[model samples]
Target: MKKLIIFCFAITLFSCNSSAQKTEQKTFEVSKTDAEWKAQLSEMAYYVLREAGTERPFTSPLNKNYKKGVYVCEACDTPLFKSEHKFDSGSGWPSFDREIKGNVAFGSDNKLGYSRDEEHCATCGGHLGHVFNDGPRDTTGKRHCINGVALKFIPKE
Candidate 1:
């Protein structure tokens, strides 16, 4: 009985250690400054990407863009969306069925006197856009309405 109890305690300790290691492994570090971001991105891109401002819809070339590529954050260069996830929502903005894992953080948006979930970059906290429930259920059942100026698409090879 003592041997069995010791074995159980060892297993628990191993499990806890593994779990702690996994948590540590999942943590990511963000290292960038305003000067670096400004130097790397245009003024408009910096406004939308660093200041969390929304760009005017129907004005982004990405809305009508059909290129196959990964859309990365304009400020941080973090991969945010894939071309396969993009779709025409006709909402005068670029829409995506889903986002790259851990790329966006969702929050309650009370802006415009309405309640909606806003999607922002997880890395830089830049407002990429908002999310809607009205989308193709066959996919992720989500409409990630994004600002085209906030993203830079790298065409697939």
Candidate 2:
């Protein structure tokens, strides 16, 4: 009788653990084709916006950009990062102190076999860029190192 009780409890615990693991593995899917993406964005925009390509540093208009507006995804026009969160990290790329709530997702980027946090658009699952821990103290202690070409700044009127 004692052995049977222990076996039942172990099975229940294992089932619960398996379900929890499955729930935690949820991820967004980005299965759009290049043609589909290009129909929504310009040539340059499509290259950097949906293809996860980086633009030349110091060449982005947003680098020295200081406007009171929202920055959105250039491809899908989804609101991702806010202008208030934008800051100069001196890395040449546009840096953000934070992203719009639930607008971006994170994943382990072992592309070069080096571990780094890669950021993606939560809505379309498009690769926006990587994030770092070094950032201003006024906002969240995170540096959302985004590609400038991936965004479109909507200046506040």
Candidate 3:
């Protein structure tokens, strides 16, 4: 009886520590060294794009931007979200209902003690932000709460 309990406990322990859920390392089209990234991006941009850090809400000037243009990845210039897809989610972050297909990637994020759908730039694997379900129902019901520091707006000509 004691041996059975010990065996079960060992199995549970090992199962919890299993690497089955470990995310695979992905290769991007654009890769650079840490130093190169730091040199190319601003301090805040580097934090949000490279380190997955979040900026203070309402701090990004892009949050209220309404001009017609495309928002691109600050690190790789990959077109991410279009201005038309952006909306005032009131989440303080620049919220988008959709992304330019294949330009953005999704991954699991459990940083906040809960699982979230994390978004990233497919071109350079730069962390953008997380996507939630609470969005405008008329369109794609996804609120891509992105860190504005991770994006660079290019006005339409």
Candidate 4:
């Protein structure tokens, strides 16, 4: 009957709007409001870190960086990865063989119509990027494909 059809439609709408399938992020030690974060981060950094946006490939200067240093979260300055793990995955973005364990957290991202492991700064819960198993077989074999704008490089002394 008409009532049955309406109920079904309402259920579908609610299901689609629900985020039950997505992994939940924990409370970060460093949290900020939208306006506060926007004020500190550059336009692109804010987009990628705060808004969960990705930057254009091969456009980040950090992508070509080969210096010795550590990569920190642009949002909260939490160290995420080291230059030692940096590798050329040819994925356009800055790829890493592994993350500095305990500094980054993983979650499920089904945004692109498929499931991908999403990475974020553990301290601030800012969106970093995704992780894959297609990295160097010699290393940890994890391709932490990160948005360059999400990181700020600190050179080794």
> Which candidate wins on TM-score?
3
Model 1: how large is the Cα RMSD against the reference?
9.6
Clashing pairs in 2: none
Candidate 1 TM-score to native: 0.74
Where does candidate 4 have its weakest 10-residue lDDT segment? 17-26
lDDT of 4 by residue, 1-101 (tens): 99999999999988987777686556789988899998999999988888789999999999989999999999888899999999998988999998998
Stretches of candidate 1 off by over 4 Å are 1-28, 31-36
Cα RMSD for predicted model 4: 3.2
From the highest TM-score down, the ranking of the candidates is 3, 4, 2, 1
lDDT of 2 by residue, 1-157 (tens): 9999999999998888775466353444555677888887777677766666677788888888998999887766779988888899999989999899888888877767799998888877677889998988867889999888888899899
Model 4 global lDDT (CA atoms, 0 to 1)? 0.92
Off by over 4 Å in 3: 1-17, 21-23
| Between candidates 1 and 2, the lDDT winner | 1
* All candidates in order of lDDT, best leading: 3, 4, 1, 2
RMSD of 3: 2.2
Q: Quick one: how many clashes does candidate 3 have?
A: 0
lDDT, residue 131, candidate 3: 95
Clashes of 4: 0
- Which residue pairs come into collision in candidate 4? none
Clash statistics: count for each candidate: 0, 0, 0, 0
For model 1, residues 45-94, the per-residue Cα lDDT tens digits are 88877776787879999999998999998767789999999999999989
Each candidate: RMSD: 9.6, 6.4, 2.2, 3.2
